[model samples]
Target: MKKLFLGFCLLVGIATKAQTVADQPFLQDSADKFSLKEGEGNVNLLQVGSDRNKAIKVLSSQGLMLLYEKNLRQDVQYRPLLDMNIVALTEYQGQFVYLTEKAVLSNAWAGKLYINHGIEAPKAMGMGPDFLTLVAGEGNFAIFKNNQEVWRSSIESLNPISVQYDPNSGQFLLLTAEGLYQVDSVLKTAKKVFDGSDLTAFSLFEDTIVLGTTNGIQLLDRKTFTLNKLDQKLPWTEITSVNNIRGNLWFGSTKGAFKLREDGKYDYYASKRWLVDDHVADIAEGPDGSVLVLTQKGMSKIDFEPMTLAQKAEYFQEIQRLRHIRYGFTSDLAMRTPGDLSTGYFHDTDNDGLWTSMYLAGELFRYAVTKSEDAKQNAYEAFEAMERLTALPDLKGFPARSFERDGYEVGLHANGFSEEWRQQWEKENGRIWQLSDDELWRWKSTTSSDESCGHFFVYALFAELAPDKEWRDRAIHQIKIEMDHIMDNDWYLMDWNGKPTAWGKWNPEYVNSFPINVGDRRLNSTLILSFLQTAYHFTKDKKYKKGAEKLIKKYGYDENANRPATVIGFVEGEDLSNKWNHSDDEMYFLTIPGFVNYSFTEEQKAAHFNAAKSHWEVERSEKNPLWNYLFALSGGENIDSEESAWWLREFPMDLIDWKIDNDHRKDLTKIAPNFRSQTYTEVLPGDERTLHLHNGAYRNNGGSDGKREYAPYIYLLPYWAGRYVEAISAPQAE
Candidate 1:
């Protein structure tokens, strides 16, 4: 009995060891904590801080008028004797307020008092105990505090910009177009801090006062009044404003938003969208070091829990592991169970589309490449099941629509628009169009039929990885069909129902009309490469290379000639001239470098690689990581020292940052305190349509192009670029 017990214990110990080995690679786990709440108005301060209980808010209601107070457990916490509402809130010893209309200054703890004003109209305002100042456009000025008039002094160029206070040192500072001034609390006087320093704003923290100008931020030791230049280089950033949260300070710059770490190092942050025009108005730290933010349209949050050194090491190992994982599949296209048939949690029932198949295929490939055998097996089964489903006779033409029982195609359903503009269209005449809820499928047909090229690429990728002839043949046939039907002689992929020629002729309800025929060349090129690469693996044909060459030539290699010659620069906000749809190009660029199987001269390969580089160079920035990820992938495969160094320098893990809670704006630089990228022009200010790449921009007017937006394509960009880590951030190979 003792011998038998010892043997069983040994078996259990081995099993335990195996399980530990499996779990070791899986790291970087995160769970969703909170759903965002909606708010309105010129929310000046949205404090989502370390103390989660303190959900205090302050916002402007009537331009200059303000409303503020923290939500209390029982009753409203009122400011004593302050009848008129507060316009702005700041901290000196505690929370202080700047009231509009009555010219009253008050504190949350201290009682309120009216300040004497010398001028009839106050254009710019700032405060200091026993002192208050107002500027009226030109050199006109007023100074008062503590309900008493004080001596006022002004020069020709003192255009007051911003004011801030340092509590620990008991000092008040004001910024103007000419220079910075130190306000004496006792004497009620203003003195210049430095000469020839035109100021924009000042950032105030616990013991830090940072002065911002066209040059850069100037840090001052509040206690000693010692000056230290934070950034000496002019145009290092075009700082619009500065914010304080917890022990850190943040800068909203023209290039992007950055967070100053406790150690005084800088890191960028965005809400994971495009905020080219909008400024990161304010930040509120939340539970577990998470931050709540307010931008122009709504609020957004980000949780940053510091990773330990061990975690960092694990992350690097996973990165190396991604290169080693090999992928394969069976040659037989036949299957016992349909790949689309699954009892999984995320199953789709809509039979018409290949959304579910593409999703599963992408997920499986991602997992498989990361060395997850279980996920690999699952992915294989998914593809096999899809093959079986495709074999169904009635569903053959890769029909645009599919029905479970009747096996019939459902025509497009439309909801009539309230406006007369869209009502003229036949598709938009009457009923509301609702897509199927449950559908397990893959894209196949290249005709006017609604199909996903994603399906073909997914199958082709599997075939290439595994060396399957049958899969390779199917991919080739599909590629030919795609080329003949949608791809024009110029290498541009036609949008809307396989129409290879002019816009709106083939399909009326297609996307953008202008160069709409060009579409996302990245996607077209990626899919073509996938087919060419896989076909080469099986047949070793130079014809595939010839075909790819033709496409490349027509499209100008990187599809630059096809895509609009513009890239949105979000220095202040998203520059609309640059926000062209390029997800397709992004995907193509990512997979182009992996075309090692194809027969090509070194010159040809170099040309293709350079084309991909052009796309990356133009689009790459802090806000957009899809481009960065693709750039890194291409760099990794090519093994070019310069490219690798470039990626490491610019697109580092800690370096990629996004703004939070910006409404869908194309340009982020133009909009202030509304991290969303918005477009602004001298003619029509704050036009989101011209600026952003969303539903707001592309509309279904009576024009050739119907109602559609490019934003959805933006989200799918990561898949084609092979930037899988950014998608799931999975540390494990699986």
Candidate 2:
């Protein structure tokens, strides 16, 4: 039986109020999970019309497809129409209705809707209850009901564009290039509804006729026959299709798709996440609360399934173990064929230790919160992987970035840099791929501060929380080795070449080399000081504490650490400071736990927590749960969790790295482009934007062209970390 250490419990109370919550039993709100099913190919989706019965009528170049879908199951039956010359299709009385060039036909209707079995080669048609109406020539309108041509009228003023049926008023609405028109088939008359120019699409919602044009959207009230232009901004304005699926207005535009929310803000769904192509041709209601979208290529269905965060974590864990693990380390999946998971292979990347460290940290947090045996086992396995990183390097506490078979990646050039360039960079510092003492394997070298930061943070968590004595001891020993090496090397993580690896330098000269506006100065200061404090806290080593004091008192490292995130933007002529480093944000938030919770003095703890809060002030708009919960370690009451939970709920269930775009969206309040890439006044919801884990910019518009897939360890880290700190409760079943 394993138990949380009492010393760690006492340490929590002594430092701050981070883990000081009683169990929350009645926390019941949950979020939905998304599942995207794509029907993708080269064929264009010409039009999407409703099916009166149980299936959908999708007219495309390939043929007419009756798409039947329910929950997780879908079936599509195609009719090539090789034997029949068909121009258009619709459903009439539970049977297929074909509008061929010669005649109007259906399997069930006894006679043609048009009198004398004649049909007009019209611009558009609208079919509804008791009537079939078509706009012929400029303004000739004809309606047929009960197998009779009820009306044939000519309105000289209207220029015809498109026709749609309004179910509420039992009337047909028509759009025009110059104005809007309405037809009362029962009354057998056509009249001008409203005056508008360049009208492209229209959909009926209650009394309002929502019209779309090249400029924007407008609403026409059926009773008043007066049009009121919709004042809301849309994602795109070159409208192609407008649909009201069960009262919600869905617009398909030349750029992408969007839905008008009740609050007047549009929920934009663009990129590969929602469509096969951004040139959406049609939008319609789908089966079982799903949204069906038709693009130039094909159709896609987006389903929202009700689930809690806890359930999501379990599902993520299962997939992470099944497809993401390589040699006990969390790894990347490089697709041999782009966009195909079957063609994926577990790729040994340069940050295997860093990524696995994060995964291990999350598992440890899960074990701390629930004491789950499986969580413990997961932590142990990942810990072993990271342990191998330290031992394989053969440099005391130094850890290799990753490892693979000897011949696996000897000549691989990654990060889009050329082989020649990489060889020169490696030669400048040291060898990057070091062959192991054993002939069968090789380990990576020149590890960065980010990798070391992840290792230190997770190792401290394991040493303090793991109940297995051997694991805890090994964790502490690694910390001592690393901390001692830094002290012995004059505050530098030295490589075998007797020089500091480019980014592993933390000496006073290196740390102070850049101007105060640069980030590396503040970041390196915080990292080494926190490393010492955590080492001292864990092993009660006086030398570690003395080393930390020497840096703080003499070199002013504490003051530098205290302002790590502030003044870290847009330093002139400095390449490192040209943009915000999201990787630095990740490292800072992850390492803040050890810095605040394991400080040597009460004064140090408070100072560290205040620094963290300062950093979070800038990061709050990002809505990252890990940053929020880690900052909550100060047990501060000022933190707001609404945005954090919003991010969690909005995270996409599909983790594929599909190419995404948001730059064209009109709904977003865009700002002048800057170094931080905070492109908009407000961030788009998670599913609508890029899924680069913690690197999500507030309004990042585009990234990733379907060549890779992330493991989603990003979600797990924050979720379990929140649970461990009681910022999040257990899953609440409804």
In candidate 2, stretches whose alpha carbon ends up further than 4 angstroms from where it belongs are 1-6, 12-44, 49-54, 67-117, 130-139, 155-161, 230-232, 410-420
Model 1 TM-score, 2 decimals: 0.44
lDDT for each residue of candidate 2 in 1-734, tens digit (9 for 90 to 100) = 12223354475553223432222222222212122245545555566655545465666655565554432222233232444445556554545665554455564555445333354444456678654645343446566665567778777755566677777777787788777776787666677768777778887777787888887888877678686666447788889888887788899889888888789888777777666667887876654566777777666665555677777778788888888888889876778776678988876776788899899988988888888998899899999999998788778888778888887863344333688978887767656788888877888776778888988988888987787999999998988888887788888777767777667889999898888889888888889988988898789989999888988999988888888466787877888998888878888887787777777777887888788778888888777887887676544444556566667767776677777777766677878877777888877777888778574456465557776778868889888876765666667656
Score candidate 2 by TM-score against the native.
0.89
TM-scores, each model vs. reference: 0.44, 0.89
- Give lDDT tens digits, candidate 1, residues 75-184: 13443423454444443333444545456454443455556454433444565544444423245455555466655666566566655555554656666756667766
Top-lDDT candidate index = 2
Candidate 1 worst ten-residue window by lDDT? 14-23
The worst-scoring run of ten residues by lDDT in candidate 2 lies at: 26-35
Please give the lDDT score at residue 302 for candidate 2: 58
lDDT of each: 0.39, 0.72
Candidate 1: global Cα-lDDT?
A: 0.39
